[model samples]
Target: PKDQRKFGYAIVGLGNYALHQILPAFAECRYARLTALVSGDPAKARRIGAEYGIGPGHIYSYENFDSIARDPEVDAVYILLPTALHSAMTVRAFKAGKHVLCETPMATSVGDCQLMLAASKRARKYLMLGYRCHFDPLTLKAVAMLNGGAVGARQVVTTDNSDINVPLSEVAHSWRFDRSLSGGGSLINLGLYGVNGTRYLLDEDPVQVQACILPNKNPLFSSVEDTVAWTLLYKSGAVAHGSSSYTIKDASTFRVLGDKGGLLMDPATSYWANRVSLISGDATQSWGTPQFTLPALNQFSAELDYLAECVARQQPPVRASGQEGLQDMRLITAMYESAHTGQPVNT
Candidate 1:
């Protein structure tokens, strides 16, 4: 018998991530299922829908997206479009009387984020941010350890999220390089992992933000930045340093330090496997590094199930709420401001 209790999700984009990660994750989702697909390309939509057992009637284009309001099977819409389009799509989903699960960096501007939140409130629909790490078992384990004094007193965090270089032709054609579509470049797209991950681990918002654009003379970055670095100051005297680049092959890694000891995670925010090690020392023992082996959980599936559970219970998402996404955009905006003015901005 089918689990009719599962929430139905209408994925609103057919991008690479949506097809590769989000769609596949549905198979592992305990509380959610793919009920519909929205894509501008009819061929892709039909093919994907057929593969997922979604009939042509459930396949929608951007032009007919609002008609989903009449679809009882579509209890929620998952917005996986580019950063700038997140706000508008979310608002429309709310108007259609559907819950929303939007991807991170929320929107291009703070005002856009606020608008999405207001729309959700007005429509009385649930809004969840796609901060997948919050629901990952490994990340949750790290957070629990840090909070449990595994690292005595939190002191510092450093993270770098960079990817392999892209050819000039591809870079020029991708929406990620377009300022209007992406808002910025590597910092907004890649560095968000570092920023959001640090904040979640520490459970504290930065008080001040300072940033600068790194030297990248490539013509590929003309429309947006290629590399950037930022520093965040916490009220507890804690500090975080982060950097990201589109031209660098650096791994997505973060190192957390405390008075007693610290932990380092290489490939921390990767979609696949990750590594974490604890470094602690005492007078008798120089230092001991222990590796942690935790249960593997699909990040996308965990987050989707989490939001579905929240909606099933008619409760707000506690971990990755819309407000959490708004705060990240606010901090990102401040980072941009700081990088432009060469002065620290109060957040």
Candidate 2:
């Protein structure tokens, strides 16, 4: 067994995101230890608990989640539940005296995000948002280039990301389509990724926002939007135009244009490291993204790894925290408000 580590973690939910992303990511993570599994399904809990070698005591059902706060074994908890359940679960976990590694979209509303933040503080726990993309090597390199003036003055940022791959028919009857369960739809679920990235690329939160949304033809799907585009104005005179869609193939990218030259990172996806190309002067410099050979560290893995380190070392994770999620919600809430009223949102 590896030597003892700090920040032992208990993961809640055993869904696809948890199975595909968080559970497998434990190998690459440094500070976090996988201590327990929580699921509404006891069979799933026991099965995964056995597979992961978690003690039976650490296994919990949804009804008994509150009892986890008193568990002596777990130092932190990772909430991998549905996007809608994030707020209540996070707040409950925080109040239970566990350091929290909350997955993104902190919540659908700034109010809930604020409540989560308050709970974290009241519990005197570290609450970090799981935004691992910012920690990826390609993203880090892009940030360095931004700091080095490679993309000088960063005038305009144009982003287009659409995934026709995820047919609504798949999740039509699921919570993802239930407006109450999934919140606002593609604007909240998919589009928020673009919003988060905009802050990272610009190195600033958006001060203003304007946007529009559209729905593709999938009658079975809820009335929630399937696609959206928004313009965000930063305090530094930089403007970002971003879009995200699940009704199309994965066409993801973030391009920053400066007074000098622009930097491009295209074909970026949630599953893989970004494909980056820096175009300057007449020559374009490029760096290959890390293809995990042995450990296969996905973005979710990187996030937990960073969270463990941050908790042990008393440092901040690369991206925003629970409060920052509140900030994003504020901007997004304002954006939705603006879209409804045909006015510019002031964040």
> On a 0 to 1 TM-score scale, where does candidate 1 land against the true structure?
0.96
Candidate 1 local lDDT, 106-158, one digit each (tens): 99999999999999999999999988888777788888888899878888999
TM values, all candidates: 0.96, 0.91
Clashing pairs in 1: none
Give me the runs in candidate 1 sitting further than 4 Å from their true place.
Answer: 164-169, 282-290
Candidate with best lDDT: 1
Superposing all C-alpha atoms, what RMSD in Å does each candidate have to the true structure? 1.9, 3.1
lDDT tens readout by residue for model 2, 241-326: 98877775676788888887777777654466466666664544443342222222467666777777777777755465776687
Model 2 error, position 294 (Å): 15
**Number of the top TM-score candidate:** 1
